[model samples]
Structures are given as structure tokens and as C-alpha cells.
Target: MKRTLVFGDIHGGLKALIQLLEKIDYSKNDRFIFLGDYVDGWSESKQLIDFLIELSQKQECIFIKGNHDAWCQEWLENDVVNDIWFLHGGKSTIESYKGIDSSHKEKHLEFFNEMKDYFVDENNNLFIHAGFSSMHGPEKEHYKTNYSWDRTLWEMALTMDERIQKDSLLYPKRLLLFNEIYIGHTPTLHYNVEIPMQGCNVWNIDTGAGFYGKLSCIDIESKEFWQSDVLQTLYPNEKGRNK
Candidate 1:
């Protein structure tokens, strides 16, 4: 049977990602939904994008845009580099492109530009890089940046009382808009866990590849998941985002 796989924030851990795919025994029949932040963490950001481009040619892929991706996209498009992006792992991303020329950068830039802020499957399963704030839904989100930057939605889910049933008036209206929501951006490490986390109807798959955690993926239907070696071990000499 074909699989619908959802991957969390990669943060440039190319080796971890490769290990994860091999562990899962990836096939062309698998449908991949990658929650972005593909760049700005480790040394292989450029190579990671190259691999994704090639993979897309052979398999179905849906790439969601994350805040880091948005920042990298701007740099690629206009040569802009701000301090926040720099301190947060953008420097490694820039260094990764040392020998690359304009043509290659342009292709990668196009890849980043084509990424979607969010994707919704027929089952009303929402896939996005981050949370949406609007009570109506992501499509109706007024601050479009919320698609890649919002955290309040996840925060609300975390605070939800399990005893408070979904049908209750106290239930969050935003969570009701979708059957299930899958996202990345806020690392689970912040919550002191190195595994995928579920809060209400939302699943946070970003297991913190940008820091001490590992890269992760989930078989959305089965809820079975896989993870790579901790990124810090994979790139032992590098500090990653922990710096």
C-alpha cells in the first residue's frame, strides 16, 4: 500500500534525512509532505535542496514554507541578510553555498519560492510549517505570516483540558476547523521531549533537528513514526542551532 508521509523541520541535516528515508524504506509510491525550514541550521542546506528537487522529480511532494525558509528565500532573491537570520543558523546556510554560482542559486531560489504556506488534503488534514491564528481557518488568516511564524495555536492546543470535550463551547474554535493538523517550526525540544508531540488535534513533528534532537517523520494514517540519529551526533563537531 502507498504511504502518506509527513516530515518535520529538517534544518539542513542532510545525513539524518537520508538515514530516515532509508530507515523507512522509501518508495516512489509514498506521498511526502515536508514541513519546511529546509535551510539555516547545518552545513548541507544547499545539498538538501538539491536532493529534494531530485526527489520531487521521482515522487509526489508537498513542501510547506517555514519562517527560516522565508528568510532564506529573501536572501536568495535580493541578497538581503539580517542579524536575526545570521545568528540563528543562516551563516551556515550561506557558507554551504561557497562554491555555488548564480545559476544554481537561482534554481534553489525558485524551489524555495514555489513552496506553499500550507496544504490541506481531502480528509481535511491540514499540513503547514507552523500554526494559523484565525478562528475561521488558515485560508482566512489575516496575518499571512502566521502561516510560518505563529505559535499561539500550538500553545492553545497544549493548554487544552482533555476533559473538555470537542463539542463543548469551551473548545477552541480554530482547532475545530480541521480534522487533524500537522505542523513544524516550534521544536518539541523546548517542551523537553525529543519525540513528536500531540496537543489536542495538532501534532508537532519538529523534533528539533536544529538543536539536540533528531529529524522525524510520521505515517500520518498509521501514526507510526521514524527518527534519525540525533543531529548533534550526526554532526558532532558542529554546534547546530544550540550555539
Candidate 2:
């Protein structure tokens, strides 16, 4: 019996991720959709990716690209490390693999290269790191990268009056076409919640594990969720959101 599970941004909280997995009692038959930002923040970005790569071999997995991952890809492909990346936790990622072997580095790059901008399951449930164009679907000519960087989709969900019927012409057609949308770029903690949040048909699962919150994983079908300890506790030596 394979189960579908979606994880929020990791941001190098390897210990948090591990604890969350254990809490869920993960099995090989599970299908996982990781909502990106696996690297950055904590100090084990490299190790976290390595574990994810190995996990893929034992279970079904879909890795969605996040904004942080885009920065990582840019750095890996062109050796371009922007100040924004470091400011947003790239410094720790870089330090994590300071003396890592080139071969291992290549493997991580390959994993990052293969990540998807967004994924729509057979049931039309959309999974993306960030949001997408509300006016158009992924088929639009806009930069596809926006699938992992856009926020309007979530913003609309956050602001809309749920009681009012969603009019296709008045709402994002993209959202209308899906049964549900799952996003991770915006931490739910910002909304004062430490758990996956549902607004309209969109689910915000990034519970700020990258900062002072916890890592969350939820079952798409059952809505059951598991979370790690406060990330700051996982990395007592590091300044998480405080940084």
C-alpha cells in the first residue's frame, strides 16, 4: 500500500528531516514529494541532499525545485554565487561541502539538475516549490522558473473569501483546473502557524523549518501530518531565523 507524502522546505535541517521521517514511520512503499529548499539554513545541506538521493532509490520521489535550489543550480552550473544566496542561507550550504569530493559534488548537481519546476498528479493536484501564474498555467510563455518563485497563487489563497464561490473568470484559472495545490516557499509560520495550512484549495506546507519553525510532512490523501522539533533546537550552535 503505497502512500503519498509531501514534505516542506528542509533548508539543511538534516536532523529535523530525519526526525520527521521517523515520526511518520516511513516505509519503502511510500511515495514522497519534497517541496524543495532542501539546502541552505542549517549546516548539513550536502548531507541532506545525499540522503534524499539515496532515498529516491528505495522509494518513489518527486523533487520540486525551489528558489534556493535555483541559486544552488546557478552556483553549480556557472560558479556564480550571488550575495542574495548567501544572505538567504547559501553560505552554510557552501560551507557544508567545503572539501567534498568532486564526484560527490557532481552527483548532487545531477540531482539538482533533474528537479522539476512543478508537478501535477493524475488527480490534478499541483505541487510546486513556490506559486505559479494565476492568469495562466505552466503552459504560459513566462519564465518557467516562476513556477518555483511565484507567490501570487498562495497570495490569492491567503486573501480570498473562501465563502464566495470561486469564479473561474474571477479567480486564477490555474487554480480552478486543479483539485488542490501544494506549495512550500512561504513558511506557514509567517502566518503564525507551525503546521500545514489550507486556504481555499491551496495548502501551504512550508512551516518555516528553514528558520525558527519545524519541518512538516503531510499525507495528501489523509491530511495526516508529522513535524520535526523546533529547527533551532536541532542546530543549537547555529543562528537560524535570527541570522
Candidate 3:
């Protein structure tokens, strides 16, 4: 079986990320999937992005845009969007690239632009940065933007049951369509736990790494998780404060 190493929501923890990679013993044959949010909450956003870019050049890596990444992309597109992006952890992202040249900013933007919204393997394992919409049929097939900010769809899926709810409006038919959906953005109580919901079809891997949470990774086939040690005081107390 192919081994895929999946991680996301780094929130700028360069040290923790390095440690985690060492534990994995990453190799040329393995594939890495990063679910986005490479910046924010911690201080190493720029470093992490740079490392990821370098890693992508040598090995297989798939990057998806997170909400934070979208903010950065918007800022890069126009200064008019700076205020909006800054409010959502773009401030830290800017700080991460302090003293860098315009070329660096362009590079980061290019990387973000190329990220995929979702990755589906031949086995039908779907990997998305955020959860999908709950609405069934055509809504599920809509482009990336629809899935990125659609919270209602995610809420419906999370609350839906596994048995006897087919085509029910209260629950989503889309959730039942995938072999497994691996997602970030919603943190789990424990970093090592996969937080299976809706009959183990959906796995939440965020582990709150940006908000007093640990960085986490999962072995997709085994459904086993690995995480950094807890660091309660790592994040700022101010609500939405950029670290």
C-alpha cells in the first residue's frame, strides 16, 4: 500500500513541524499532502512555506488553500484587500516575510495560486482543506470557492446520521458519497485522535494547532495519527490575535 503523510494548520510552528517530519522519516517514495494554513498563530510562517516549496520540488506534495491562505492570496492580489486579510492572520504572515523582496512575495503568491482545493485519489479518498457543503446533488459538484467558505454544508454533514437518512434534506447526501474525507480547520480535543464522525467516514485532523492545539499528522491507510506534544501557553490569549 502507498503511504501518504497528511498534515495541515501548522500555524507557523517551525520547530514542531521539523520534529514531526523527523519522526516520520520522510522519503522519496512517500507522498505528502499539506491541507494549508502554513502561516499564522506561530512565528515561522515564512520558513514553513519556504520549506514546503522546496520539498514540493523534490517529492510528491499536494497543497490546498486554507482560509488563512485565501486571505494571503487576496492581499497579494490587491492592497485594497489587505485590511480584510490582515484581520484573518495575514498580519503574522506579513511579518513572516519581513525584509523580503517583492520577488519573494510574488513567489509566495504563485505557490498559493497553484494549490488545489481538493485531492481525490484513485481509491476515492477525498482530501480537502475545509469540509464540503451539506446540500446534495449539483451543489457538491460546484467549484472550489463554494466548498471553501460554506459552513452550513459542513454542519449538516457533521450532524447527519449513517443509517436510513438517504436523500433527507436535514442531512447531506454528499457525506455518504466519499470513501473517506480527510479535513482540517476543526480542531480535535486530542491531537492523536482521528476524531471519527458520521461512521468514520470523515476525519478531522486540525487538532487546534493554531489555538493552543498541537500540530497533527495521519497515516491515511491505517487511520493512525501522530501529533506534537501539547503546549497550552503557545498561543496568544487575545481573540484572533496573530502570533
> Listing every candidate in turn, what is its Cα RMSD in Å to the true structure after a full C-alpha superposition?
0.8, 1.4, 3.7
**Candidate 1 whole-model C-alpha lDDT, 0 to 1:** 0.93
Candidate 1 local lDDT, 75-171, one digit each (tens): 8888889789999999999998888888998899889989999999989999998898989999999999999999999999998889999889999
Which regions of candidate 3 fall more than 4 Å away from where they truly are? Answer: 134-144, 162-171, 189-200, 231-243
The global C-alpha lDDT for each of the candidates, from Candidate 1 onward, is: 0.93, 0.87, 0.69
Reference-based TM-score of each model: 0.98, 0.95, 0.82
Model 3 / residue 243 / CA error / Å: 10
Clashes of each: 0, 0, 1
Q: What C-alpha lDDT, on a 0 to 100 scale, does residue 104 get in candidate 3?
A: 87
lDDT tens string, model 2, 1-243? 778899999999999988988899878888899999998899999899999999999889999999898898788778788898988899988888888787987998999999998898988898989887746677662778777788888888888866667764566566687899999999887789989999888999999988899999999999999999999998999986456
Candidate 1: list runs displaced more than 4 Å.
none
Residue pair clashes in candidate 2:
none
Evaluation by TM-score, superior candidate among 1 and 3 = 1
> What's model 2's TM-score?
0.95
The candidates, ranked best first by TM-score, are 1, 2, 3
Clashing pairs in 1: none
